[model samples]
Target: MPSSSVPSSPSWHTRVELPSDVPAVHELTVAAFGRPTEAELLGRLRTDAGWIDALSVVVTLATDTGSPVGHVVLTRAFIDDVPALAMGPVSVHPDHQRSGAGSAAVRASLDAARAMGERYVFLLGHPSYYPRFGFGRASAHGVTLTVDAPDEAWMALSLTPAEHPLPSGTARWAAAFAMP
Candidate 1:
């Protein structure tokens, strides 16, 4: 899979896991971002009392010796008061760039969201990277952001068009994400 490659060495395995792996997930995020801001954000989100456990996905090495190399988190957000999922802060360790670890993490998170019956997901990220996951410009669906951001950077994905469909309104992230 494109999401499980090892860019330089071509010798790592990426697999998804449960919340018990938070510490390793944090380490991977720190290593990937070279800072604690993203990690802190994730920490705050996890304890916010509103986090949806089933939507959090972590990608780790298949072997016991392999440490977590990438992380992706999806949490409850809103579109004009309509419940939705927000994808963000996806991280792949510097050494693992182009290895597909980040892609795998995203794919896993999306799958989890679908299974949990979530219909819409929003993200403010690279205009390029997220399209492969069926994400498109949120503006196309009437979705907007409260804070200033590039229009192309804000995207959304709908898992069930028949039911909830896409929402049109301002995106509202959790309070933890709202903190500076």
Candidate 2:
């Protein structure tokens, strides 16, 4: 169920940066997730064929500390062979959770996607969290996942309602995501 309370914004610096920031971004992901797997996945996605240049975003504290407090990434995915985006593994430093770092990253990334003319986006994420960004059950729009997931956990968002609209089909990640 969606929370009755809106999430409070984090008090930190948030902006998008260049590929030169990839290392710091990876480190932030590892620290936030407490695992190397997501870091590895992000690395692979950087070189994947489906990667999109403008969709990656980084969020950091406002103090100019030169360290990222959170990160969010989106890459090209497909629904029924139609172009879309996939948001994943957004991470915020454990100490910074509820500070709005993660939400800032997500909001930035989605804004970037919309600016780039993307229509749809899919994500496997916290049921309670993503809806604040306009995400709804993928099945509600005829989208699904190859791997099993609860209906509430797999979600989709439409950035351009008039053009691509919402499509129904399996969400296919880039080849990088298929690697071990």
Give the number of the best model, judged by TM-score.
2
Q: Which regions of candidate 2 deviate over 4 angstroms?
A: 1-10, 162-164
True lDDT of residue 77, candidate 2? 90
Model 2 per-residue lDDT tens digits across residues 26-145:
878898889999999998988999887777778877766467878888999998698888898798878788888888899899988888878889999999999999998999888978
Overall lDDT per candidate, in order of appearance: 0.80, 0.84
* Candidate 1 ranges with C-alpha deviation above 4 Å: 1-20, 162-164
TM-score of candidate 1 relative to the true fold: 0.85
Superposed Cα deviation of residue 130, candidate 1 (Å) = 0.3
Q: In candidate 2, which residue pairs get closer than 3 Å at backbone N, Cα or C atoms, i.e. clash? A: 10-99, 10-100, 13-61, 13-62, 142-168
- Compose the digit string of candidate 1's lDDT tens values, residues 1-180: 468865553444444446567888888789888899999998998887558877676666555434677878888888888989888779887877777778878888888888878889999899988999999999999998888889999899898877766979988888889822
TM-score of each predicted structure versus truth: 0.85, 0.88
RMSD of each: 4.9, 5.6
